[model samples]
Target: MSRILAILQKEFLQMKRDRLTLGMVFMLPLVQLLLFGYAIQTEVKHISTVVFDQSMSIESRDLLDSFSSSGYFDITGTAKGYAEITKMIDSGKAKAGIIFPPDFAEKLRKGETAPVQVLVDASDSMVSNSAIAVANSIGLLKSQKIIMQKTGVQSLPYDIRVRPWYNPDGITAYYMVPAILGIIVTMTMVMMTSMGIVREREKGTLEQLMVTPVKSYELMIGKVIPYIALGYLQITVALLVGGVVFGVPIRGSILQLYLLTLFFITASLGIGIFISNIARNQMQAFQMSFFVFLPSIMLSGFMFPREAMPSIIQYIGNIFPLTFYLTIIRGIVLKGIGFPYLIPQVMSLLVFSVIMMTLSIIKFKKKIA
Candidate 1:
């Protein structure tokens, strides 16, 4: 009991010695939250578009107005021909190009189908998809308007209404900020914890501790305690930034988030400890931590959806604790889901925590390598 407290005090003292690093740790979440919240947007808008209106008539202008008013396309410049639009897209000057045939208005007046070509830079899938969808919608709406005017129909026969829950505005931050919290926690636990142990080993302090009367598990717990505190501190800071800066609501019980966070933090810490046991120095620890970190970011559904991945890839994603933690945190923060709704995720993290901690404990020898 006293030994664990003594080790905790020692770890805290070492951490206090590096005041700059400690400060940086706290600031990590704030900076990343702001940067990622602003940068990562799934619902991409304001795509730079080039227009080539051969008709240059009122009908063509009306279609251009529809594209511009949709907020998805911004008419950056007018292209003289298909060759110019091709040059603009290839040179990265514009993402999309809208071209109206010379007989566009004539076809509309004569009740014939007008062919308007929309060229999109498919290099970026998101931008291309957005441009294509919006262009098609604009065409559909204008066609319906013209049909209504001719046929004298007041409204469409069928109405399909969509209700977007959690974030009705499709605000990227509301979805990303909470997930960023999980990321921050993972980075701190895996990178910091592993690096801290490796740093101790590099400084020969690990051998000094191992020579003491403290049990291996006790020493592990004591060393882990400080980082656990730091993990919660980071979570708190990230949640605060998510809520205050991004207006992400904590619709569920904050208590549930904190509680579920324990399993994730411990699991991450265990992974870190395992890395420390394998790595001889801090550089190795940093590199090895990425083995876990990169997978957590890519496979954990942080920036991408797991459902879209191949079946085998999705199964591989289950190995990362961050995968489960993302579900728990996003569920609690966005969906207001309680522990009952998060049993599978919580259980997965619990199992991971046990497995990783056990492996780390068994792998860590009480002697110098």
Candidate 2:
């Protein structure tokens, strides 16, 4: 216990001495919350669109008004032909092109299904999805309204209503902020711990540590405990900022959320410790951390839905601790759910922590490499 306390004290002192890393520990969460909270929006709007209306009629103008009023399409320029519309989209001047045939208004008057072409740049999937959904919805609604007016019927034969839970207005920040907190903790815990140990090894401080009476497990625990505290600090900052600045609701028990977060923090710290054991220097440690970081962001359901991914990729994502943590944090913060719903995720994190810590202890050498 005394040896562990001494190592813990040594680590705290080292962290204090490294002002830049210490600053980053506090600042990174705030910056990411602000950046991602405001920047990454699922409700895509004001897509730059080019219109080519060959039908010079009041009916065509009204249809254009419908598109503009929907707030999804912003007509910036007009094209004379499909060739010009394609060129604008290719040049990045527009994301969508709405081309109406010469008979668009005539077809509508004759009670025929008007074939107005909508070209969307599918390179950006999110933007494309938004445009496509809105465009299709606009067409459907307009057709329905026309049919209702002609038949003098108030209701359609079938009506489907969607009620979104957690976020009623579909606010992206509300969904993203909680996951961002998990991501921040993961990044700091993994990269900092891995790099810190490798740095100590490079500076010969690890050799000094080897000569001490402290055991390898004691060193690992001491090194990891401080980072666990730092991880909590990061989580606290993210919660405060997310709640106060972004108005993200914490519907569940704050105590339960903090308690369960211990498993995740420890799990991430173990991964870092494991990385430190295998890495020869700080550079290698950083490389390994980066390798882990990519999968966490991409496969952890942070930016995209894992359900949309291939079954093989989904299986690969389960290997990462962040994938489970995302479900836990989002479930707690957004849904306000409790332990019953979280047991599976919590158990998974616990198992991962145990495995990583065991591997790290086995791999950690007391002697100089």
Candidate 3:
């Protein structure tokens, strides 16, 4: 009993000296509770939308108003044509596009059913599904209203036509592939760099390297380049597996995917290097990497819906590199979108890479003492 008590005291003393580790130990649980509690929601809302109202009639305008007022969609822009609608969706400018055909009101007024094409960017299945549901409900309610006014009947008279674009069937693979790519990069980049640094420390090579004439920035570059190559290799393997094993189509340019992935790899490697600087041993490095991994998987819209999360948790997720990377990957893979549409995600990734790499370099110390 006395021996155990002495061991516990020694451990506590060690922890007291390592304030970062101690702080992480105490703060992680509380952070997880708050984050998961608010960020793990399944319900999606406030989807951004665009309207291409070719009809320009009272009926078509009323229908558009119905959608905007429903609280599910925020009408952000007005598209001029079908091409513009497609452009908006591809560029991540809008989640859904509501198009009213030229004769929509005429057909409806003539007692003939008119089709309103709802083009949904179904890469994010949760948001797409929610938007489709809301659109259908609005159509049905409007039809019922027309019926009640014309025929004194409360039944629905017209069909609320729905056409989900991009992913017509809403396959889970279509939605998950891009997100899984983000997770893979995060796990491999962080774990490999952390473990590699810790191994160097364990073998006493880190001290030897420090004594060499290599500049700090040069050494950092050398360490990161190899990991960046490894990241590309992992992406290649994962892409192949997704295509062959899961039948997930690569609709966009492979070169674009690789370039975008390069940005993400660097960002992830930056995080790993930062963790390596903080952790003293391999076990500690592994623990710290896991701490980062769990939140990333949960909060970056990888497994859960970001819309369901409280506003604060959603904002917290924006800090992660994966959150932006997922958007780029999904846009390319599922929507066949190019740089014009992917600028925002690319910019976000660039900013993240710059910040993380700068922080890691700044935090890196040249001497063991």
Candidate 4:
């Protein structure tokens, strides 16, 4: 009993002297809570929409008003022609486009069937599916309202034409593959870097390295760079699997995806280094890595819908680095959106990277006691 107490006392003393590890043990959970709680929303709101109102009549205008008032579609601009609608979708200016035919009002007035065409960019299958469902429901409600006001007879007057672009079937794999790539990178980079340093500590190599003339920053760089290369390798493997096996198409520029992934990888590596600096052994490092990993998978809207979760939990999910990376990768790969549309996610990743790397470097010890 006394011998066990002695060992415990020695371990606690060592932990107390290692401010980095102590701080991490206390701070990581709290920080993760605040971040994931606010950022992990799944329910999509404020979808950008474009309208091509060829009818330009009271009925067409009233129907457009019904859509905009639903709170799902945000009417950003009006398209003058069918070509304009296609352009808006291709340029990533809108997620949905409503085209009213020239005979829409004429047919409605005569009680003849008319089709209202809705074009949706279905590259993001989840978002597109949601938008389509909402649009269809709105159309049904409007038709019912028109019947109730006119002849007091509720009946279906016209069909709402829904055209889903890019992915007609709304395949889950198409949307998930790009996101999985981001997850793969995060898992590899963080786990590899975190375990690498702790393994050195367990092997007694960290003590020897500390006694050398190499500075803390130099050692940190050496530790991180190799893992960055490994991250790229993992990314390559994930992309190949997504493409060749799952048949996920790369609609956007590969260069763009790679560049954005570089940024995300660096951020994840920073987190791993932070974890390694604080963990006393490989077991502790693995525990800490899992702590980060579980939340990332759940909260990042990877496998589950963020909106379906309670608001508080959704917010907690956003703090994981994977959450923002998922958004960036999905936007670029599925939507073909450029930097202008992706600035918010990229900035968040950059901020996280800077803070984590700074904390790790500042808390790093130079002398071996």
lDDT of each: 0.90, 0.90, 0.77, 0.77
Residue-level lDDT of model 1, residues 1-369, one tens digit each, is 999999999999989999997998888998899888997788889999999999999999988998999999999999998899999999999999999999999998999999999999989999998988888888899889889999999989999999999989999998889898889888989999899888988999877877888787788788888998998998899888888888889999999889889989888988999999999999999999998899889999997999999999999999999999999988999999999999999899989889987787667645333
lDDT, candidate 3, 1-369, per-residue tens: 443344345444654686875454334333433343345445577788999999899998888888889988888999999899999899998999988889999999898999999989899988988888988999887887787898887555566889987878766666765566677678768876776677678789778866876565555555555556555665676677567655778889999999888888878887898888888899888999998898888898888779999999999998888888888898899989978898887888788878877776666644333
Q: Model 3: how far is 348 from its true place, Å?
A: 1.7
Which prediction has more favorable TM-score, 2 or 4? Answer: 2
lDDT of 2 by residue, 166-219 (tens): 999888899899999889988888998899888889999988878887787787
Tell how far residue 312 is off in model 1, in angstroms: 1.0
Candidate 4 error regions (>4 Å): 1-155, 365-369
Q: Candidate 3: deviation at residue 22, Å?
A: 33
Error of 4 at 336 (Å): 1.3
Candidate 2: segments with Cα more than 4 A from true spot: 365-369
How many backbone overlaps does candidate 4 show?
13
Model 2: clashing residue pairs? none
Q: Clashing residue pairs in candidate 1, if any?
A: none
